[model samples]
Each structure stands twice: as C-alpha cells, then as structure tokens.
Target: MSSRKSILEAIKAIPREEKPLPDLPDFGISGELEEGFTQSILGNKGEVLEKSVFENWLATQDFSKILSLTESYRNLSTIELPKDPHELSTLDLAILEGQFGVAENGAIWLDDSQLFLRAIPFITEHLVIVLDRKNLVPTLHQAYQRIGDAHSGFGLFVAGPSKTADIEQSLVIGAHGAKSLRVVWK
Candidate 1:
C-alpha cells in the first residue's frame, strides 16, 4: 500500500475507549438579567437603545444603503438581496432581529432565520439588532439550553463590533467588520 494509505490504516487500527459525556452542572446566574445584559453590552462597546428615543434618532440619519429584517421595521428593507454575498461590500447599515441575548456576555444569537444573508451583518458599516426585552437570559448556560434542538444552517453569537488589537496592542473597532452595533428593544 502507499505510505498515505498505510498511515491512514495504522491510525484507524488504534484501539479506542468510549467515554460518557460529562453532565452539565446547574450553576445558573441570578439577578436582573436586563441590568447585567446592559452592563455586558457596554463592556463590549455596544449600546442598547430605548424604543421611544430610537424612533426619533433613526429618522434623523441618512444612510446610503439600509436593510431591515426585524418584524417591527420590516417596511424599511431597501436593497434587493443579491445572489452573491460579495455584492454587499458597500452595504451601509443592516438592521436584524436577534432571537435572544445573553446577559453573561452581551452576546446576541442569530441564525438563518434572522440573517438571511450570512454576510449582511459583517459587511454592513453599522449593525442594529432588534430583540425582545423578555428574551434576555441570565447566562450562556441558559442560552444554550434554550437553543437546544433548534436547527439552522448558520448560527452565531455576535457580541459587538469587530475589534482587534493585534497590530500593535492598540484597540481598533470595525477593522474588518461592522463599525458599530446598537441593540433596540420594544
């Protein structure tokens, strides 16, 4: 046999033992999930907007391109979703709905359901996520439990705008992704 095939066969011949998965411990966090969530968001360099004030503030801006996929702002969808994700390179703003938010880290969950195009959130200059006030969880443990058995092609927890300090240990936001993030709730 060839060296590559022999190597593969030898690897497969190694004996293995089965191991039971460890049980998930119950160590859920307590306190006001909303308050903790807000603090977490601030630490991640993201902001939460009050519904009343957001409406007025949103109307004042003039973004070149805008896309809204949230239920409340569905009427604002302007761009025709393109077949190629690269076509969104110039996207200015993207408003999407987050299924839920994690209080422990201010991470918001989105999948194919909310992110119609995988690149929409990443390519947009500014990202706005709409979440239900009641959907905040105290911790990621609960968040994972809540997502169990759910199915989707793409899923992720977006915490804040893309940031990097690799260049020279200096913080830079939107170096490769959304420049800002704002979460709005009804």
Candidate 2:
C-alpha cells in the first residue's frame, strides 16, 4: 500500500478570497443536471430573429451530412458552422442577437440571446451549454447597459432550470424551461 499523507496538508494548497463577496441572486443550476452548464450565443439581431421565428431556418442548409453528438446535447444534430459565420443556416447555434438585464450576482448578463429553443438540443434527449467566461459580468446593473434600448422583439433572462417550491416548500425542477444548467468559467 502507498503511504498516506495527512489530510491537513491538502487544505493548505487551496486559495482563499482576498475580498468580501457581494450579495446576488442565485441563478446556478441544481439537482440531477447540477453538474452540467453549457450555453451558446449567436451574434446580431437579424440572425437571432430569423432563427427563433422560423422553423425552416436551416431549410436551405445541408443538414443531410453532419453527424450528431451523444452526451447531453444528444437532441442536437451535428450541424456544421458556415464557412462564413454570417450564413444564417451555417452555425450549429447562431448568436445573432442579445438584450441585457440586471443580474443580482457578479455573474454575466442573460437574455433571449441564448434561450429560445423550440425543441431539444440533441436527438437523444436533453440539452447542455458551456458559456464562454468572457461574457461574465459583476452585477445586473451592468447587464442593462449592454442591452441599451434595442427592443427589436421578444427576449428573456433564464437562470438554471425552471424550479418551484410550492408543494409543502419542496423544490421541483423542469417545470417550464430546461432541466439543468452548468456555468463553467475559465
């Protein structure tokens, strides 16, 4: 058997916060999907509207070739990103638009820019999104600035799965939107 090291030695390696943390809203995912947090954002407004409003968004694109993924996004077919990212039907998830809102936490802002899906992300069932860390913000106030006054159409800010504690204060998830969320930062 290998020699065992004292448990106290391991704790010393961990880093501690240098400053006091600020109060904020809880938007992290919990429960079975507690460990999964992946998100994709498209750029611009025209692209965002086209994708959300039309089901045939990929009609002209060649979805007959790419394969699909198995993990959490099994529902999503492996659609290839266009050679020119601007080709509406080219991206697996085209981030064509975004409207910011106040976040109660030091986390980044959110809006319809990421969550307006009509179906599952993978064919197998369920979905997953690993957001880019650069998008993170310190508070919701900053999020509003990002939005400005561009209210072209519909939008929202989603935090984790749809959960409720109505039945005897018991928390339940997956009631309205996604079943899980996992926010991984760099």
Candidate 3:
C-alpha cells in the first residue's frame, strides 16, 4: 500500500469514544427581557429602533443598493439577492429577519435559511434586522435551547455593528464589517 493509504488505514483503525455533553447551568434571570436586551446592545454601541419610529425613519433615507429579506420591508428593497456572495460586498444596506434575541448579550440568532447570502449582513455598509418583540429570551442557555434543531448547517449570533480596538486600543466601528446596525423590534 502507498504511504498515504497506509496512514489513512492506521487512522481508521484507532478506537473512537463518545463523550457525553456537559450540563449547562441555568442562568435564567427574571426581568424585562426587552429592557436588558436594549441595554446590552447600547453597551455594544448599537441602536434599537421602535417599529413605529422606524417607519418614518425608513422613508427619509436614500439607499442606492438595498436588499431586504423580511416580508414587511420587501416593497422597499431595491434589488434581488444575488447568487454570488461576492456581489453582496457592494450593498449599501441589507435588511434581514432575526430568529430571536438573547437579553444577556444582546445577541440575535440567524440561520442560513434566513440569510439568502451569508455575507449580506457583514459585507454591507449598514444592516437592519427586524425581530418580533416577543422572541426575546433571558439568557444564552435559553436561547440555545430555543434554537435546538432549528438551524440548517450554519447559524450565527450577531450582537452589534462590527468593531475593532486592535490598533492602539482605540475603538473603530465598521472596521471589519457593517458600520451601523439598526434593530427594529416589532
């Protein structure tokens, strides 16, 4: 046998063991989930918009290249989602649907199905997420429980706009991704 085939056969001969998953602690706190979620997002330098206010705000903006995946804002979307991920890099704004929000960290769950193109959120200049107010959870433990068996291959928890303090400890927003993130709660 060739060296590569022998190496593969040797690797396959090794015994495999199955380990039990660790038990996650319950950190569920009782309070207003929306309030906690809003506070956490603010701490991360993100903006929260009420649905009523967002309507008026949306009408005033002039975006050249926009993509909307949410049903509520489909009328406002300028272009269809392109097949190529590379095409998303030039998007000025991308509006997407979020599965749920975690109050403890202000993170929102997004799966591949919701994102027509995975790069739409990160590559755009600005990103907008529409989430139902009732979908807010108290902690990550609860969030993970809620997301169990729901994701399709890929999922992510997006908190706020991209920021980096790698250079001289000075914070820079939009350093690696979207410069602004606006979460509209309905």
Candidate 4:
C-alpha cells in the first residue's frame, strides 16, 4: 500500500470519542422583555420606534433616495433601484424586514430571502428594519433554535450601526456601513 493509504488505514484504527453537547445557560430576565430589548438597543446606539408611529416618523425624514423591500411599503422608494450593485453606493436609505429580534442583545435577523441585494443594508447611508413584537426571543440560544437549518444560504444578525474602534480605542460609527439603524416594531 502507498504511504497515504497506510496513513488512512492507521487513522481508521484509532478509537473515536463522542461528547454530549453542553446545555445553554438560562440568563434570567427581569422586568418586561420589550423594556430589556429597548434598553439593549439604546445601549448599542440604535433607535427604536413603534409600528403605530412609523408613518409619523417617516414624515420627519429628509432623505431623497430610498428603497423599501417590505410589502407594507412596496411603493415607498423615491428612486428606482439601479441594475448595478456599484450604483447603489449613493443610496440614502434602505428599509427591510427582519425575521426576528433578540431581546437580550438588540439584534435583528436578516436573510437573503428578503434582501434584493445582499449589499443594500451594508452600503446604504441609513437603514430601517421592521420587526414584529411577537417574533422577539429572550436569548441567542433560542434564536439559534428558531433558525435551525432554515436559512441555508445567507443570514445575519445586525445589532446596530456599523461601529469600530482602533488601537487607541477611539470609537468610529458608520465607518464602513450604514450611519444609522432604526428598528420599527409592532
């Protein structure tokens, strides 16, 4: 037998060990869940608005270019989306629908099923995500359980606006992505 074949046979002779998966810890929550979620979002420097007040909030915006992928706001785009992704660099705002929100850390889940282009959220100057209150979960462990094997292609959890800190620890917000993120929920 060849050296590679001999090595493979030798490896197959070794015993294998199986280990049980560790249980996720329960991080006890205090007070109302929405309150905790709101606080987390605030700590991440993101804004939150109720679904009832979303239209009123929309009236206060001065953005000239906008795109809305949500069915509720299907006709809300001011400019037609360009065919080329590179042309979207100047997009002022992009409105999307998140599948769910995590209460513990103010993160919302987005997947390719909803995004027209994967870069729309990251390239836009501002972003608006609409999530339902009923879809909120208390922890990431539960979040993972809910998303198990469902999103096979692409998905992400966006906590807040793009932020980064350099070696000196000076924080930079919107350095490479959306300058602002607003969560409109029901």
TM-score of each: 0.84, 0.39, 0.84, 0.89
Q: Cα RMSD for candidate 3?
A: 3.7
- Let me know the TM-score candidate 3 reaches against the reference structure: 0.84
Q: Report lDDT per candidate.
A: 0.88, 0.36, 0.88, 0.86
Q: What is the lDDT of residue 166 in candidate 3?
A: 98
Candidate 1's error at 145, in angstroms? 1.6
Separately for all candidates shown, the number of backbone clashes (residues 3 or more apart, or on different chains) is 0, 26, 0, 0
User: Per-residue alpha-carbon lDDT of model 2 for 23-117, expressed as tens digits?
Assistant: 66655434222122122221100111122323353345444433222232334455533343233222233221222212233222444344343
Query: lDDT by residue for model 3 over 23-104, one digit each (tens)?
Result: 8787765678898998988888888999878888877988889899999989878888888988777799889999999999
Q: Which scores greater on TM-score, model 1 or model 2? A: 1
Candidate 4, run of 10 with poorest lDDT: 27-36
Quote the positional error of residue 15 for candidate 3 in Å: 17
Tens digits of lDDT, candidate 1, 19-126: 999987755456787888888899999999998777787789888788888879877777877889898888888999999999889999999998888988889999
TM-score of predicted structure 4: 0.89
| CA shift of 9, model 3, Å | 17
Where's the lowest-lDDT run of ten residues in candidate 1?
24-33
